[model samples]
Target: MPDSNTKDQIIKSMLNTAFYKSAGETSLANIAEGVNIKKASIYNHFNSREHLIEETCRSCKEYIEQISFIPSDIDSVSKKYPAETVLKGIVDRYFKMHEKQPLIQIYTFIQSQKYFTPEVMDIIQAQKTALISQTEKVLLSLIQNEKINLDSNDVHSTAMWFCSAINDMLSNYLLERKKDMLPFPEKNADKMANAKSDDAAIEKINAYIEKFAELLK
Candidate 1:
């Protein structure tokens, strides 16, 4: 069995891989150079490149789970805060998570590459599915409480739309980095408080909020 020190080094090596290279192209040599170890030494800790990357992504997911992604209980949050406030907070958290783990952006960008290793694709799907499931749950709670109303008889579709909007914006933010991409966010969203100066972003986000509001009634 690998000692804790060896395991930690392997993880660090994998993170460097995510930041600098995609799974399709990453090799034992690449990791060895990043970890400052000989290529054969990596096999002492992990069996293969796939094993290393899978472990790395799993570690990333575990770390994210502890990052205070959300605190409020969905039903209670909807009851206590306006729908807009709660929804905006969801969007804000999404961005904040990206900010905290900028490597995840690079990781995701690489994962979206034309050729994804099966292990890498599994990691991506697991994260995406988990978020979609959580979003659907909160959305159902909000809808049952009449916090956000819509004519769609399909709760799943409506919930997906809300979640997808945030995901789309995030993808655009990472891939494009366009200043005028999405809304700049509002005053209450402390994470993006500086966005007030960007009128164009604000206008776009407000329009997004207004569209959501219209969907309510």
Candidate 2:
């Protein structure tokens, strides 16, 4: 087995490349070159490029989970934090973590390759399911405690909506969407303004989520 240190070094190389480069474009030779190892040495740690991508993706998921601390189970997180505070914190982490970490860059890279490989699609779908599920769990808690109320009986749908809205807003910020791109320049201008308001987290999310938050109250 490759020593743990060498193995870690290899994975780190994958992550750095994963953000800026597509999975299809990321060659093991390039990774080895970056790591100061022979091209053949990559096979010593991972069986193939696909295997390396999978391993790198695993680390990506772990990095997100560890840094965000959004638990899979609701009870693991303390309820003392109000729903607004907790939800805002998670949303803040989603935006700020992407700023401070490689999650979005790597995620965007892999997503750009969805047509090139099934493995990338699988990772994307699994992560989306996990995110929706986690959001549902938290929304359930919020509903139980009377933090937010929904018109729909389906928590799953509303949970998906809540998460989707936040994601759309965040994506707009990342893509730098602006009034010029839309037919309604005024509305688009307002949206662009909202996306940048409040240091790029709170107000943007509110523009997407406040209606739902109002439902909570």
Candidate 3:
């Protein structure tokens, strides 16, 4: 068995592979090879392929938490824009994070709940809970500010729609990126072709959010 430091290095190396490689390209054998270790060595650290993927994903979640964008304050959002615009901005920030971190790939798992073990599913659920709570807080602020009618079903539906729309659009966008297709052509074609910089995802997501926000009216 590898020492603790070596095991840590192996985990990091595996996660790095998951981050850079296409989602379809990542597997346990691939991770083992990248770390110059055998499959048994990998098993020594993790219980199964699903567990390994979960660990890699856990690393990704941490990386995302460290580097991801935080949505601007609700007060600032209300002061600067309408309630619908504020909600869109919040969802857009989430979309941007998912786009830039395709290797993280947890959002789609949260949306689909397939291809992940129950434990990994739990982790993703926790993340989603945090996201929804944040969104709810923003919506509540809008209601308080009188930017949205608190008792109106329209406002409630709008908030729910905002979350679903962003996830649906961004997940489809990432799947297309994996397939090298022009899912958001005209705006995303160049970025898809290049596929190297993180900024491409950021630009497209922000633009999509801006457009989707306008559509909320």
TM-score for each candidate, following the candidate numbering: 0.70, 0.69, 0.61
Q: How do the candidates rank by TM-score, highest first?
A: 1, 2, 3
Top candidate (lDDT): 2
lDDT of 1 at 38: 89
Candidate 2 collision pairs: 148-216
The segments of candidate 3 whose C-alpha lies over 4 angstroms from its true place after superposition are: 1-27, 37-40, 47-51, 57-72, 102-116, 152-158, 181-217
Off by over 4 Å in 1: 24-30, 57-68, 102-114, 151-153, 176-206
Is candidate 1 or 3 superior in TM-score? 1
Give Cα-based local distance difference scores for all models: 0.60, 0.64, 0.57
Among all windows of 10 consecutive residues in model 2, the one with the lowest summed lDDT is 178-187
Question: Could you give candidate 3's per-residue lDDT for residues 52-72 as a string of tens digits?
Answer: 656656654675455433355
- Can you rank all candidates by lDDT, best first? 2, 1, 3
Cα error of candidate 2 at position 72, Å:
8.6
lDDT measured at residue 58 in model 2 versus the true structure, 0 to 100: 69
Compute the lDDT for candidate 1.
0.60
Question: Per-residue CA lDDT of candidate 2, range 50-129, in tens?
Answer: 78867776666665545433655554442566676767767766665554335545556556667865666777676667
Candidate 3 lDDT trough over 10 residues, lowest sum:
180-189
Per-residue lDDT tens digits for candidate 1, residues 1-217, read 7677877776766554544454556678876776778899988878877777667766665654444445457788877877777767766676656643334433453355426446556655666666676767766777777887754366667767766776666665544332322343211233432322334544565568667856775
